[model samples]
Target: MPTSSRPAAFATAALTAGLALWTSGAPSVVYPVYGREWSLPPALTTVVFGTYPVTLLVVLGLFGGISDRIGRRAAIVLGLALMAVGTLAFALAPSIGVLLVGRALTGAGVGFALSPATAALAEYARPGRGHLAGAVATASTAAGLTVALLLGGLFLDLLPDPLHLSYWPLLGAVLVVLVLALRLPSGARSSGSAVRLLRVDPSMRGVVAQGALGVAAAYGTGGVVLALGADVAVGLLGTDSPIVIGLVLALSAVTIGVTALLARRVRAGAAAPAGALVMVAGLAALVTASAAGSLPVFLVSIVLTGVGYSLLFSAGVGIAAELAPAQHRASTVSAVYFAGYAVQAVAAIGLGQLATAHGLLPAIVAGAVVLSVLALVAGAAPFVRARRAVRTATGGNPA
Candidate 1:
């Protein structure tokens, strides 16, 4: 709870949460192969993929604040252990059912790690970093996702040991991160009492509402792309290489990090609106790119969406931290993430079906529609509030 350690804590938390989200990326390199190897339908394949977040949401919602009673290191260590075990299970998975078990475990590990890791970051942040903490966390998560997909592609394409190699390497890396997390100085910041569900404060209501949509915008697009983008590039866009898939997906994360850098320079309120505008533009670009089969436009659209996604996520996190009680910060952040995963799970299943029937374009259209409508509307809500604040400050309505 010192003044100088917050950023480190934020980074550490992001790394830890990345470990969990990274597992979701576990299926990336071999989605088609995995589906074929397991004899799953496109819909079922997406569900197999969706299992992680489904279990993740359940575990996080149920046990989000347990670290408040125990400690940050304990939650992280436990989560990492669970993730490792899940990977090992994945290594030996002979059936899709077994894969779900592993994914479920991975989800649970994420569930356990996410909230506490975030809270520990706040407790440990440096002076005056309250604004940028969320950006750092969300950006790290995005970066981890990008790396996971790339690595998954590498192992699948280059290595003979598809089952053993892709995730096992990551398992080793998780152990290394676990060792580093052990060194972080999160001395029991939680109150000395039994862990219980913390109530949401009134100030958090608006942020939660925005976060629910913002999270959906970022992650929903992620699900849609990961599920269908490569194939669209191949079947629809007339390409046969995995490199295109990796590059397109990976570019979004790069854009997310870049936008995070941009957000750090401005106030969260300003960034929030800009993020929504950028998201709408991105959605438009995505549609145009897909419709015209323009790879350049596709890449450009992803970049725009990534910027908006990162900014929206950062703004939501800042607002949650500002509004939530110190003790309940972890729960609040996880709750926002909960909405994100919920959107992802639904998008994967529903969009998979849509992709099955009408092709991937419809699902992609649905995502753009939802994100453009929700994030833009919420982003505009503040302009009115900002104008009212200005009027009040001047003691008269401006002409």
Candidate 2:
């Protein structure tokens, strides 16, 4: 690749990253509409949401390192093509079954594309500034999420074909990104077992665990927000307008992008613990908001969650970048995301069932407890390791 082309490649890669989230979230605002039109239960709606991550988990496990062997450009193009197909499915879907299929295809597409795009960001980063790739990746995904919520809401509120119109634009965006992906440099391919590429070294296992936990905490919170935030907003705001719901929910994504840029200078080790603490606070606020049906508190919770998500996600990416072998970078990043999405799948589906069986408030309280514990554990892991190291150095004596 020419030096001149690197910048374009970087931008294209970022766009691909953005498209992955944009595609995943495109259906979020329409989920409630599906329920109303189809007379579906809350559990069924959440199943549709959870379907994406469930399929993504399978793809990530099997093909997470495919880009390393097939070339980044090839992997990305294939992923985007699948995304376009999935988006089209959503646009034409008239039944819940079709929607599930669409969600699955979109999940598979993201599983294939996101890790590779993230690795490509580092590959194209300027020398000595590789860290910026993680921040840029975070900001780009946040931007995508923001657009999905904001525009999906707008289309749902103002357009005649609320269910289908939002997805047509998303499909077009996927095709456009697919074109840009084709122009990206076809970097050299290597031969390796995908499973072998995903294996973490014994020495790096602890760091990998911490990174994965932090990412899981972020994704878990985000899953709740995406899965149930709209209903929560409607309850609190006393409005059924999709546009208002979207604007209110989009606050989290807006804060995520802004915080990633502002906190780019923060070190991963520091950011991980700090983000965990903030996430705990956010979860508490969320629980309070649900109990009181307070819109202002809900707003605060959304902003806090977004800030926490940015910190944790960027830090996880930073850790993966710093520790990954050049040959297996994509696989390493995928492994981190795999953990995150697994938690997200569980949270979305489980919370939905809880909400359906009990009530939204109880479900929110339960989710907050689980997420808070996860965040606290992620925050404490680094310190625990540091203390262990100190003890070992002192021959098991107290400091």
Candidate 3:
């Protein structure tokens, strides 16, 4: 690869990473429309939402390290092709069955592309700014979500075919990216079993665990928001206008990009704990906003959630990139993503079902509680270990 092309490659890789989330979130604003048109329950709507991560989990487990063996460009191009197909399926879908299939395909595409794209960022990053890859990655994904919400809302409100029109643009974007990805220089390739490549070394297991937990918290928050944020907004605002709801929900995505940029210089170790605390506050505010039907509070919560998500996700990615062996970087990042998507899958379906059975408020509270605990544990793990090391060094004396 020529040094001159690295910047282009880096930009393309970022777009590829962004497109993965864009594909995943493309259907979010339209979920309510689908439910009304199809007479679907909240549980089934969430099933549609959760389907993506479930399929993504399977693909990641199976071939998360495929890029390491093949090449980043090849894997990304392949993923984009699948995503285009998936988008087409959504554009033409007549029934929920086809939609589910499309969602699965999109999930598989993201699973294939996202980790490789993240890894590519680190590789293509400028010499001194390599650590910024994680922040950039977080911002890219947030930008994707922001675009999906804003455009989906706009199309739904103004376009003739609300359900189908939005996806066509997405499909076109995927195709364009696919072509650009093809021109990306093929990086080094190595031979290894996908399973073996994904395996974390014993020495790095603790780091991987902490990184995974932080990512889980960030992604789980996003899952809950994407799954239920629209309905929550409807409850708070007492309106069903798609455009308004989209704007409200998009606050989180917008804040994510801002926070990532502002916090890019923050160290991962400090960012993790700060993010956890801020996330806990956001979750509390969310529950309060829902309970009181306070739109202002809801807006505050959304901003806080986005900021927290940016911090935690960037920190997690930074930790993984800093510690991962060069040969297995993609696989290591995939492992972190694998954990995040797992929690995201569980949160989406579980909370959706909870909302259907009890109410949205209870579901929100439950999710908030669980995610807050996890965030705290992830944030505190490094400190706990350091304290234990100090104790051992001092013959079991308290630090």
Candidate 4:
């Protein structure tokens, strides 16, 4: 009803947007929805899941910072429309072609909304509580991923009308969010110098390095495992149940979801190193899983890596926000995201290709190696910066 309540509204919008995008994959929990009903192939399933990131990366890259120039409201409203269209299309799909189209549309919608939604959170932030925006971004994203899979599975197993139940309810919820979206003040207005957005000025090589190393570590480990683990789980381990899918692929991020709950307690510098360590541990577990082809070890690794990915993702947002100038905060975030997605894209393609050749486990080892290097860099960056700062402050060198 009031402008001051916009942040609360945006938080809801972001959460909804996330939920919508995740359904594109979460319905895999209801593999019956597509697998048997449409006779969808395994390759097609990979396409369905992989297509979201492709469209998402492209849309976010081009339009990611449009809100910074055009205003957050328009970007968000457009994104919501896209998300609604895409989700509904998939829900009502008469064929796999339409399903793919729907998935593409979902990606486009979430991509449009993704950046704008974050920007909206910025505008809607509560007084004297700016970090609320970051928390909203991180938590909503994690919420979307977790809730989408869990609820989608529940509806699939328990409801007679799984498709309608899984999607229509979400569509209705987004309708409520659309109504809520109307209340947000246009982000184009000048908020004045008193409240400035501290942005990560990425022209600085240091900021780019910070973003690249930090995000690569998290995404390389978590994104890779999440994206590819399913094939390994199903193709190699020979499983068809939703519960198994959730445990292997989705549950990996569940640990990250748990870590997100601990965001407030973690220190500024600690998240990166901690994330690095946990991810490394996760990758190591993955190594065992890869060698032994043990689903149990693989499942445990997913949980551990997820915790680290969540922490690093959220922490990266904060750090990226800090490195920027006031005018470019959103773009700084965009840059960080671009790099993150870029890393994921490369890792996916490279590993996917390798998986195509050497087999899933070897491909997984490649991803682990990439992330392990990234983790090393992440563990190194803070110390380098700290030492440099100390050297400058001391007017020479360290003892």
Candidate 5:
């Protein structure tokens, strides 16, 4: 690729990857409205919410390495086209069934674009700036998510068709990305069966395990907060404004973007484990604040959670990118996200059901407790591995 084209290619790929989250995040702002308009339960709202991740996981598992075979730009363009269709589906949704299908299509678009776009960015980056590419990809995801929440909420508050009106801008943006995708340099092609490529390398199993756990903890907690956090926020803030809920939910994405940019230099090993621990602390605080209905503390907790999410996800992506062979980079990254999104899919519906059956407080607290514990366990794994390495280096001696 020419030097001049590199920047444009990277930006397009990054934004393409971002639409994955943008499509998902936009619906979150309208979940409450869906509940009222349809007279549906929390679990139904969650089902619509959960469908996206499930579709993402399916696409990633089956076609994760398709870009490695055909071309990165092709895969991304295809994904963007699918997302545009999904946006249209959401805009025209006449029933809950249609909304669920729209969410699934959106997830499929994300799954198609996410890993390949990230790999494309890494490949197109200037030498020695690979890490920066990874950070930008992560940050782009956060940016898309933040924009979706803010705009969705704003349109919902100000527009007539709260649900359909919010998706118009998203549809236009996806079309723009499609045009940009055509201009992006086609990544080098290689011969390989996507099935074989989709298989995770045994040597990378340990780190992949740790990354999976960390990502699961981070994304699972995020699913709960974004899907149900609006209800919790209303209780704490004593307001039903979608903008307030969106802003509150947006703290997570904003922090993720800012923190990813700032922490680009940090090593993945240090960042991942430490981030997991901090996430645990943040989740604990969130549970407490939600239970007590304290707005200030809730804000503080979300900030912490946001920061922690940024660190964990960025580090996790960095670790996967570092470990995977260049040939399998897209597949490895897809696998990592497959694990993460699968967890989110399960957590969203499970927590939503809990909220509907018990109440938001108990459900939120339970989710926090589970995520905190998962993070703690994930955080301990790196130390344990380091200790075992030390013993081997010292020939069975503790020192």
Candidate 6:
């Protein structure tokens, strides 16, 4: 492919990926509204949220690798169409049942689009600058969420039907992207069953596994924060302002975009482990703040966790993309997301249940403990390998 044309394709794919996340972000700021209007519980709020990831997980399992066989263009277009329809559903939703349907549709769209769009960005990236694809993908994801939170908050503040009005422009955006996606070049079709593509090469197994775990750890924390953070804020800070909550959530995503852009030069091998450790510390602080009802501490934790998530997501996606052969690249990336989102689905609902049953403090403590342990182990693995390699090269002691 010529360098001249790749940027357009890359931009289209990035936008597609961004839009997929945009759909996810739409509901994040509005869940409280649902609870207030319908008189629902926190667990139900999380359930509505969980619908997206649950469907996303199913789509990834069944079709994550399908793009390799079908062609990226087809897969991307289908995903965008589903998202557009899903947003329309949101506009018309009058009940929680209807909202769940919309969420499922949105999740299915995202699931289909996520891996292929990511892989497409890599394919369209300029030669020798492939790592930028991962950074761009991370930034794009953050950008989508940022727009949704800020705009949703604004609309909610000023409008009578904030949910319906906010989705109108989002639906328009999805439609416009669908048209733009039509211009993207068709992907090279690989000859193999989609199931076969799902298999990581023997050489790439360890790296991919590590990348998956890093991504999962990062994504799991995000899941908890997104699902429960607003409620926690309301409880601890005693504020009912949706805009403030939106700003807080938006801050995390802003940090992610900035951190990812700055860390473009860092190798995945180093980024993953360092990110993992930082994430653990951040989660600990997050738990502490929630337990103590300290708004300041919670703010700090949000920033740190966003930075850590940026590092982990960018590094994990980059590592997976760089290591996989072109034929299996989409599948490999999908597999990594599959693992992360699986954790996300569980984390969202589990935390919600814990918060409802045992109390928010216990839930936060429990989630932090689990995520910290996972991050520590995942982060340390790379350094351990590096040390052993150093020892092997030195034939025992380096001194």
Q: Which candidate should be chosen as best, given TM-score against the real structure?
A: 3
lDDT of 5 by residue, 1-399 (tens): 333288888788888878878887888778778999989996688678778777888889889878877788878888888899989999999999989888888888888888888887777778877766557777999999999989987898899888788899999999988887888777778987654435677766766677777777778878877767777788878888878888888888898899889988886777777788779778888888887878888887888888788778877776776656677777777877888888887787788778878988889888988888877766776677678778978998985
- Summing lDDT over every window of 10 consecutive residues in candidate 1, give the lowest-scoring window: 1-10
> What are the per-residue Cα lDDT tens digits for candidate 3 across 284-368?
9989998998989888889888888998999888778766766777778889999998998789888978988999999999999
Residue 183 displacement (Å), model 1: 2.9
**Per-prediction TM-score to the true structure, in the order listed:** 0.88, 0.92, 0.93, 0.83, 0.91, 0.91
Q: What C-alpha lDDT does candidate 4 achieve relative to the native structure?
A: 0.67
Screening candidate 4 with a backbone cut-off below 3 angstroms (N, C-alpha, C), the clashing residue pairs are 7-124, 199-324, 199-325, 200-323, 200-324, 201-324, 256-306
* Candidate 1 per-residue lDDT over residues 323-373, each given as its tens digit: 566666766877777887887777767777777789777767877797688
lDDT of 5: 0.81
lDDT of 6 by residue, 1-399 (tens): 232267888999999988987898887777778898889887687688778888898888778887888888888988999898889999999888888889999999998888989998888888888877778889999999899988888888989998688899899999998888887788878776654325666766766777788788888989888877777777766876878878888888999999989998888878887788789878988988987889998988899889889888888888787768777787789888988888887887888788889888888888889988877766776676577668878998866
lDDT of 6 at 104: 92
Best by lDDT: 3
> Which regions in candidate 5 have their CA more than 4 angstroms from the true location?
1-4, 38-46, 192-197, 384-399
Please count the clashing residue pairs in each candidate, in the order shown. 4, 0, 0, 7, 0, 0
User: How good is model 4 by TM-score?
Assistant: 0.83
| 129 Cα displacement, candidate 4 (Å) | 4.5
- What would the per-residue lDDT of candidate 2 be over residues 1-399, giving only the tens digit for each residue? 233288888999899999998998888778878999889997798688778888899898889888888889988988999899999999999899999999999999998899989989888887777777778889999999989989998998789988998898889989988888888888768987644435565666666687788889889999898767877988888997878888887889999999999998887868878988899899899989988888889999999999889988888887786667767777788888889989988897789778888999888899999998998887777787678778888999965
- Report the lDDT tens digits of candidate 4 across residue range 342-377: 787688767877888888778888788878878878
Order the numbered candidates by lDDT, best leading.
Answer: 3, 2, 6, 5, 1, 4
Instruction: Go through the candidates in order and give each one's C-alpha lDDT.
Output: 0.72, 0.85, 0.86, 0.67, 0.81, 0.84
lDDT at position 330, candidate 6: 79
Better of 1 and 4 by TM-score: 1
